[model samples]
Target: MDLTIHQNCPSCGAPIELHEADRLIRCPYCEVKNFMVSRGVLRFVLPDRAPENIERSEMFYAPYLRFKGNIYYCKGKHQKYKVVDTTQQGMNARALPPSLGLRPQAMPVSLVTEEIQGTFLRQTVKAKTLLERAALLTVIDSEKIKAPFYHRAYIGESLSCIYLPLYIKDEILYDAVTNKPLASGGSAENMRKSGSGYHPTWTPHFLATLCPQCGDALTGEHDSLILSCHNCHSSWAEQQGKFHSIDWSCVVSAETSMYYLPFWKIRVRSTAFGLETFADFLRITNQPLVIQEKHTEMDLVFWVPSFKLRPSTFLRMGKNITLRQAKIPDGEPKMVQRMHPVTLQRKEAIQSLKSILAGAALNKKKLLPLLPDLSFQPMSTELIYLPFSDKGHDFVQEQTGISLAKSVLHFGRKL
Candidate 1:
């Protein structure tokens, strides 16, 4: 008979049953929610069909850290040269047995549906060392270009994590899920013996939004970095595991019934490449954008979507819009009707904005040589809910009458 192990709640010391797939659990006695942290490292296996004849086979999971982000390099002084490139790579810090003959490949794994079962190989390599090594490799492989001054390389907006499953049987190494032999001719004695116990080495913190003042549940969009407490009529932005109060406003539309979208209203003082104002940006780029003197001091506001969107689409939308202060009516709308379960954070939105600006500057052939230090001063980060009309699979912006496909907005049937 198969035996199941029951673990006690960390908060209340009450016995609780947990499945392998359970990432989060709540204590019934103490009403405390706990997040499952992996001990050592956890990697996901690729979804593939098992071989028909393989009735019983040994399986194991190997660790590989996947890194994704923008790589930037800068060199020189007066006429500086800079390059920013996006990259995704998988790196294996550990030395694999010669018989395995498997090369690490970057691929997405569905953590929710996929079942990861097998012995997890201990990570012998440190995460920091691996990142530095990968960064160095990227720099070395890049096309050689001459710079007049100092050289500096760095990565921005980066995320890294490990993923797994390699199978072995009869001196042949196979992919755990696919059952495809990766290599043959290795002695079975060369591989490490499977251990009987499985334990997590690291813990993942659960993302939860609660009103700081009233201790009530807060609501926000899936991609929102800001959340609002309806009970206390307060709004806050979450950053670095803390929440700060912020000012918010919504555009009042004529439509009686409407849904609001969240956006990050950002303002920044950029000092780079001899550019200071919006007019300067337009003049340098020679774009046909017109700016009046009265609106010159107006902060550069970026209306970034608080929901998930395709990268290309997100950039396009951000580039087309101009920032201006919205005129509010007598009484503002209640926060309860506008808050959503926000998933994206302020840091991520800022990263996207920076990427967009960099790309635009490069394309315009203006300010491409000088690396600017963009100091973003959060004048006020608001959760502005713009009115949108639901048209089945598309949402039409009430003000601009622009119809956006639901898929592009990542607003599936859940909306």
Candidate 2:
């Protein structure tokens, strides 16, 4: 469902196009990068194909919400992953198609602009509802997996609203893109009352990538969700339409990191479960080592990779980091020249907590019973960048002894 979004560079006023998921806007003309600050859900429109002489007032837009991401679930002892990339009608009116089909994929789209002459139909369907439907549409085959217990999580999701243009001609509703008359949906009147005219409030806006602590420009790749400031030696992530200072750290290692891979260090206060401390985790997971005083004294925190990777690597990487969190010495947070882009947002990382816990547990049958009641009350979170040696085909972190294939990283970017 990813599509190109046309934008004008704030620096040079030169037009630049970026994928819908991209947050960083790099100008080819000016050669300067700026972060795209969006206050609400990103909105894009399908180019219309109404008759050239048609008046602008005859056109109106229908809304569709697209959900793209990965869903991970634990069934008994088996961990499975499902890919979901689907679109649903964003409006309540049944007259319109339930989906735009492959229109969005086949045609070019433009970011909604205030200058548009047509009206935008209000999006009546909540994103949560659409996402639920998408989950159901892409659910893993229940017949194949024989687990009585199941817990699922959605991560790395990209949510956006796309508008389909329609036109009214000769008192008949017509698809603006194809100029085809409506098959069954009644006259244009039904479409008009779908909602109050859609407003520009949902349009994505841009903000300068300036460090709030120090007015220096922040830096990150187009898809990087977390941006770093070299001047302040700190990191910031977009939260609720604004920049929030992220508590981050870097572990010093003998091997210079080719890419300081970022990982989310999250501590959760679980209800109806004894998962609050490292000792509890050790006991529940049936660790080979006998529980000791030091283990009990250590707080339990999960380390989740802040980037996309293969399902196997994702679980292994998170487990390896969590197992060694206590030993991974605290080091100063430094922004390296070649830091890996954080593709996964913090909330998305949190969604995988329960799944990771399930993967780490020794006995799935015992752990599955406690999952429904395991409420993750996040106490605190931090971004920890670990030094990873650049192996020819993969990345190896000596401290954690975790290796990630370069192909996994490359394929994840496309995801």
Question: Candidate 2: which stretches are off by over 4 Å?
Answer: 92-94, 138-140, 144-150, 193-198
Off by over 4 Å in 1: 1-59, 66-119, 122-162, 167-174, 178-201, 205-210, 220-227, 235-247, 323-333, 336-341, 358-363, 371-380, 390-403, 411-415
Q: What is candidate 2's local distance difference test score?
A: 0.79
TM-score of candidate 1 to 2 decimals: 0.60
Each model's lDDT: 0.48, 0.79
Give lDDT tens digits, candidate 2, residues 211-256. 9999999988889888889998988888767888989988766655
- 349, model 1: CA deviation in Å? 1.9
Q: At residue 399, what lDDT does model 1 achieve? A: 66
TM-score of each: 0.60, 0.92
**Residue pair clashes in candidate 2:** none
Which lDDT value does model 1 have at 304?
A: 67
